[model samples]
Target: MKILYKKGIAAVCRIAALYFMAFLIGACPVAAEEEQKTPGIHTWADLQEAINESGPGELITLTGNLTALSSDSGLMIPAGKHLTLDLNGYVLDRNLDSWGEFGSVIQVNAGAVLTVRDSSVSGGTITGGYHNNGGGILNRGTLILESGRITGNTVLHTGGGISNDGTAILLGGSITGNEALLNGGGVCNKPKGHMTICADVVSGNQAPEYDDVFNQGTLTLQEAEPEEFHFEDMTVVRSYMEELAILPFLVMLAILLYVVWIDSYLSRERKRIMLWIVLLVLSLILQNYTEYRMSMQVG
Candidate 1:
């Protein structure tokens, strides 16, 4: 057990720490430019300069724990041909619409792939907080979130955790406490994008669990099916037909009794009363619907 720990985990942390130092020394300048990248710039302008000068496929490593409290972010990885913002357990900038101001912690374009490892992305809410569509990661191309945590990110739409406009393969990690205005409170796959949720835990998310498929790709759910079935537990959240027999009818009955008793004395407003009655009756008819549901009283 000890041997595996050192080889798999301990070694990775050590390498990250070592490389982080090297990253701050301007050792990796993308080779395409004369400008050298530093570890701790302590300002948003310097961080922006590093991003502007960064080249495709360049590795910007954090040597030390650089905090971007001011306007400047710890690192600004914008949309380019291809690049990777290697975070060695360092914190990114914390603010509003940071992606718009400084761009995402790292943005990927179409057909591009952004890979993140052993890191934490906080400061964003479920609705456009830390990330946009591809919330924690706004990807028009592709994204690989491996062995990390994307929490405190919020989106007004799908993928409160991650909105994948393209293909997204979830190799490892946990995506919780994210909110989506629409589907996939945890993750949203739009367009031709695909998401592989394997060997991970997706719980404690807000918003409706809609089709993880935002893109027309196949929505593959690779989890164990529960024995006790429920309407909400399934794909559907509401049952109109069930409400007709139970809740809707009961509610309609109460409304009719109230209107007839109170408005009976006001004969001059007969037309108005009739209008309300017709509207309520129409609502009852339209509200009725049926679906294959299991009894909640089952053992």
Candidate 2:
């Protein structure tokens, strides 16, 4: 019975060590698959259909300029959906009728989330012709502007560039060359709105009341430097760390239990000591490699 018990403990330790190594191997980054290119959106119908069919948090990129028709009111993002539009140096312009009448170029419905960014350094433009209000964008949901140019939009009432009734966060962008006859040539934060401008260029806007911005709700201008960690890079590192963190603790616990429960057997067994050393060394190597990869990604 003593011999059988000793064999069972040894097997358990071996199994634990194997599992530890397996987990460490799993933490290594897999070779990325060839990415499939998302087709560009050209026509208004295709654009709206893509938005309607897109899942939450999906990214849609533009390859060419798109102009809204006179019959079209605006591009509407429905509630409860989150979408990101990456303008790859393309324009989103609103087409005006002979009378130069049109609605806002884009309207974000309440309970939705929209992020507008430019993949190219020159950035993309969101401009419009004459409109009643919010010539460029009328946002009632959450809006995140990472990088883009909102310019050359003229409005009769307010918000020539952007009308934010919900939450708006400007991480890096330029809001300029927008004109409002009444107020808020660059941006308008309505009564229930909340806006935070961290890094943005707001100038060359003309308004009868407020030249650049009109705020009735809460508005904060941080004017701070950009954050070191980007979302995409951080996500990859975080997932690997979260999965890899548990294996070390389990391996140490197994080693501890083995030492405590069978000290005499462990001391007599040189093989067991070597096995522990190997596992520790391998664990250290894997941990260092993972950390190095993370540093490279962030740096």
Candidate 3:
């Protein structure tokens, strides 16, 4: 009975150790195999289909120009998903129709995130909107635009280029040649909305009031500075140390010490002591190698 109890306790400890190690070192779960596949959008139908198939954090790329064939709202991003639409130098045009009850080119719903990059939105005409806004794009969720163009869009009331009722980040883009009947010819930041422009151009827009941009909410304009790195700076060394994640290493060391204690208490076998020594050496080697790689990346 005594021998059996000792064996059971040893087994439990071994299982616990293995579980803890796995919890610390295991990789994050990957997306589904189907979701891993990136599909290209060419036509309006293809773009809609791709959006439907996308999951959160998925990327969809546009390969060619897409013209809206119907008078419906063009390309809605589903709620609760963070989707990135890479235009890849493509154009999305509304075909000069007075369409879209809401947004003409793209509509981002509440609790969703949409990132548009390297594209152009043109010829969008939004009439009779819910709030008479967003001719080119309507964003109720988070919207990010990078290296794109918004031009030749018209709205009946406000926000000829974009109507942001949520958060919008414009990074290195151009908003030009858009017209709004009332306010915000280039972009409208609503009362509850926030717009941040970092190194973007807002020019050649027309509106009855606030021709370039209308901000009823929080609007931040920041100039981007070119980053310069100097190898001789001691701050680089401090940053590298922070990136090394020393807390995790300390926790690992504590766990290893506990493992050693357990082994010492259970058995005094030369084989088990040798095994623990080998594991300790391996752990140190791995930790040092990881730290070296991180330092190299920082440098």
Candidate 4:
């Protein structure tokens, strides 16, 4: 009886061990897949492939400049997907007249959300079609530009740089040197579309009617405050502000590292570090407050 019981216990232990191993093996692939699923885009084909595979809220970064070889339809955002394309200081050139069809350099389909930043869209020409609009970008969905350039685009009808039939928000960028044969050389907001330009420059665009912008729908322009940096001017102030914006975060990180390193040291050193941090933070706060007050008084 004892021999039989020992055999049964050994068999049970082996089965349990097998089950545990299987469970671990099954779990490893999932974690590994997530870690390995980094998407990179260097060419137009790679960008298209990544866009097709990505779902909503996925961010795709451009690894290099991509110039369209053929006039095939530009990159299309899948419907219902909110994707962010980080241009990473790259350029998307449509290589105008490569194809005999009408297409924008970047098309945001209906019900899709696309945010483009830190990139440039140029050398796109849209013509000879029913929808000859938005030579640089045709947005039927929601489009947002944080900082980029839309220039040197041509359209036969309207929106030499951008055409919107949905919603577009320009936070900071420049739309210049685009030409439209008819109207809205910089941007065209259709009847169903809405555009909000907050601190963007729309200038030097050529159109028969509205040289800079044409709005048939809702258009709101929020000019920057006098003290704020005007991105269009590209002045010394803008450059200074851009450079200074990262200093506060860097200082905070340094302070954090100092605190961590001093945790094992004497109480006096800890107190001194704490005092320095407090003083630095307080100075920053006071400086910001003073600037705000001065701006208000000037206004």
Candidate 5:
């Protein structure tokens, strides 16, 4: 009875924590003076107004992607404060009807510190005489991209997918299938910033010259190994090599591991269980540090 009660309380706490996290991902920690723009709820003028009106140590949220094309508008996050720009969802093709030529899906002007996550940018078409610097994302400050897709965009200059001219760090995500008419098809990392593609892909991006794909950037490809895991108290086992989903892998692994470990016909095997446990312990040691390092960098 005591154990059952304890389990019930733990479950309730876990659920409450999850809800709290969902609200706080882009909600609190920012100063009250900072303004928030829920593009889904507010107008472009409202978003820009809040950004300009926000004081230092303040932040502005892009509740969703800003299709502020050629509006000559990308958000500006002031320095000295932690300005987190949560892309909440996808930022699609720019609004060409708004900006004539000098437009970008996103342009973080100089001297700002910004953090973006859990979002994407795609289908950017800049037809006017002006250039589309970054079809997806353009940064001139401190930028961080965590866990999402940045694909299928065309650019004329650096970072056909993304261009960071100041200090930047890309911790984990896909940087592929973007086009550069003149420069880097995937990324043009200038300035003193560094890009570490930890356990990710930098493939399938296009450049005018194949040899001209990468220039003036340092790429450290620290690939992560497949995780060895068993699933959901099931019999199967699954291992993930690249960017595979978690729940599916767990389901498969449970089935496989059960088959290898148990049998109604076979007597209990102490040796086998011990061997597997030792292997698991070693894997935990190796993987913990790698996962920790990937999460710490600012990209």
Candidate 6:
């Protein structure tokens, strides 16, 4: 009876060992997958593939600067995907040459969510083409800019930095050194889009119509001071003529100086000299008053 009991115990131990081994073997692949990290993207093709094939809410990290190929239309985040692009202090350039005349640098399609942070979008000098708008980024879905730089992009039509057609939330970022031929050198918010800027993030942009931003849709500046953003159409304290008149004022002052100091007849004419001085003083007063009003409005 003792020998029979020892055999039964040995059989139970063998069965338990087998079950433990099976559990480890079944868990090995999943553990390995969990331990593996996705490689950082280094090339444009690789980046595009990652953007296209990534699952929703996947993170794509850039390992280096990437420039689009000549034949590429552009990188696009497809509809219904949510992706976060960590620029990793690198750049996503559309091109350095004339290839940017074709398509935008990045297009976030409708129903997609893209968050760009910690990098630069400073290439893509776009020119005459069907894709003249949104040289840096064309966002039709939801875009969140947490931090980074959008600079040095040139577009023929509008939105040299970014064109928003859906929703854009700018928490922090610099949109500078971008140029648009017509309007909205930094950003263009379209008629159907909604944009909210919660920080001071735009400056040094160039356009004939609007220097920093053009808002045809809804623009909410949450807690942003009036002096923080320069909008051509929305200056409350000054008109366009008032802004442009500074140079003419300087020119007139120069003429007055020449008449008072250089021209012999005007220099001797006390009444004319007094008249010029009075006019100069009045101009200075007007300029000062305009600036004071602007400051009050800002305050």
Q: Write the per-residue lDDT of candidate 4 for residues 1-299, one digit (tens) a residue.
A: 98778668755754553354344333222322443456546677788888888765665666677877653557788788777766656677777742236567888889988877663353222222123798888999988876677887888899988999999887766788888889999999999999988754688989999998999999988787323533332223443564465466446545544544454332677557655654554455445544543332221
List the candidates' TM-scores in order.
0.48, 0.64, 0.59, 0.60, 0.49, 0.62
lDDT by residue (tens digit), candidate 1, 246-288: 5544454455445444542336565365556545544443333
Q: Write the residue-wise lDDT of candidate 2 on 32-111 in tens digits.
A: 21122234477876788888887866667776889887676678889987888777677888765322544777888999
How many clashes show up per model? 24, 0, 0, 0, 21, 0
Model 6 scores a TM of 0.62
Preferred candidate (TM-score higher): 1 or 5? 5
Model 3 per-residue lDDT tens digits across residues 1-299: 99788778877876676565555443312123223444546577888888878775655666667776655456788788777766656677766545345446778888988777653453212222222578777889988776567777888877888889999877656778888988999899999999987754577889999998899999988676212211132223544665565467456657765665657335667437645764764475466556554433321
| Candidate 2 to native Cα RMSD, angstroms | 7.1
Worst 10 contiguous positions by lDDT, candidate 1: 290-299
User: Between the candidate structures 1 and 6, which one is better when assessed by lDDT?
Assistant: 6
User: How many angstroms is residue 181 displaced in model 6 relative to the true structure, after the best TM-score fit?
Assistant: 0.4
Ranking, TM-score, top scorer first = 2, 6, 4, 3, 5, 1
Candidate 6, which segments miss by more than 4 Å at Cα? 1-40, 96-102, 119-131, 224-299
Distance from true location, Cα of 36 in model 2, Å: 7.5
Q: Where is the poorest 10-residue window by lDDT in model 4? A: 122-131
Q: Which ten residues in a row have the lowest lDDT in candidate 5?
A: 230-239
Q: List, residue by residue over 92-162, the lDDT tens digit for candidate 5.
A: 34554222344545566677655545433532221211135565567676666554556666666666667
Candidate 4, pairs of clashing residues: none
| Model 4 vs. true fold: TM | 0.60
| Deviating ranges (above 4 Å) for candidate 4 | 1-35, 97-100, 119-131, 225-299
* Model 3 regions more than 4 Å off: 1-40, 119-131, 225-299
